[model samples]
Target: GGIPQVIARSYLAWWLGSPAWSPDGSRIAYGVYLEGSPDGDTVQIWTVNPDGTHPRLLVNLGECRAACAEGLAWSPDGSMLAFHSIRGVPAGTRAIYTVRADGSGLRRINRDGLQPSWSPDGSRLAFVRFPTPGGIPGEITHGELLTMASDGSDAIPVLEDVALSPNGLAWNPVG
Candidate 1:
């Protein structure tokens, strides 16, 4: 009886990246890229109850021309989610965005950042920043480990002089 159950099923699109759980574990949030759409392809965020009910669209991040929205992280208090969107512009420019769980207050936080993980206290977020911008799509390149305030300010480099391209992030749970 230890097997997990499927909570939801998608019809026309495939999930784009990792899904994140709310701080209290009451819900799950994930992104999906629409497929076979006459309008066009776009990545959108959605959240659903664990029982596969009440699936709702949170935000529509348009036109993932080269890269898709990946890496979803919920704020410790469950107020917002921070994730990166790789837009069609600049070829490979990745940017971070945060949106309220209820689909309000969506804003782009940083450019050239990915894999945003929240600090244990939710006061800051750490992400990977690419150096010199513009790189080959879907290829790992040199980057730096950097952190910034939850409001997307006060960015500081935590490590440098090393070839790094982080694919995921998590804070020490104990805090």
Candidate 2:
């Protein structure tokens, strides 16, 4: 491995996490949390060139009352990006959304899903679905693994009643 290099830095951001490389490796997409904004603390999605140049805001979550986005994934052809947003848009629970690489065509895919992983062919996505919190406080009973068309239709559970890590879904690159 080569020496690590810092490509992006931010003093205004509360934190930056979930960096995803575009399929062509030309750009990186990530989420940033900015505190003390006019809309209070908010999370936004951004993209930057691999060389740390031409950073651009892709999605602004400031409109959501209290939304944060993470778990970004790029479509195989680099035409779109998928991410999970908490309390976004419809503003209640976490959901999956996609947007064009140029930061347009924003759309929600699944009403409840997280950590989306695009299928090798980019025709489908696999994600985790944690059951809503219940019973004792701060206790989660289990989660399910699901796959659906990239358009968010025909979702079918692959595994249910299992402990699935929120960020554990990944498709086989070779498939």
Pick by TM-score: which candidate is best? 1
lDDT of 2 at 71: 80
Whole-structure CA lDDT of model 1: 0.80
Least lDDT summed over 10 consecutive residues: which range in candidate 2? 132-141
Candidate 1 Cα outliers beyond 4 Å, as residue runs:
132-140
Q: How accurate is candidate 2 locally (lDDT)?
A: 0.81
- Candidate 1 least-lDDT 10 residues: 132-141
Q: List the candidate 2 regions with Cα displacement exceeding 4 Å.
A: 38-40, 63-67, 88-92, 134-141
Q: Give the TM-score of candidate 2.
A: 0.87
Task: Put down candidate 1 lDDT per residue, 94-148, tens digits, no spaces.
Answer: 8889999999998998977888999989899998877765333345677678899
Clashing pairs in 2: none
Clashes of each: 0, 0
Q: For candidate 2, give the lDDT of residue 69.
A: 73
| TM-score for each model | 0.88, 0.87
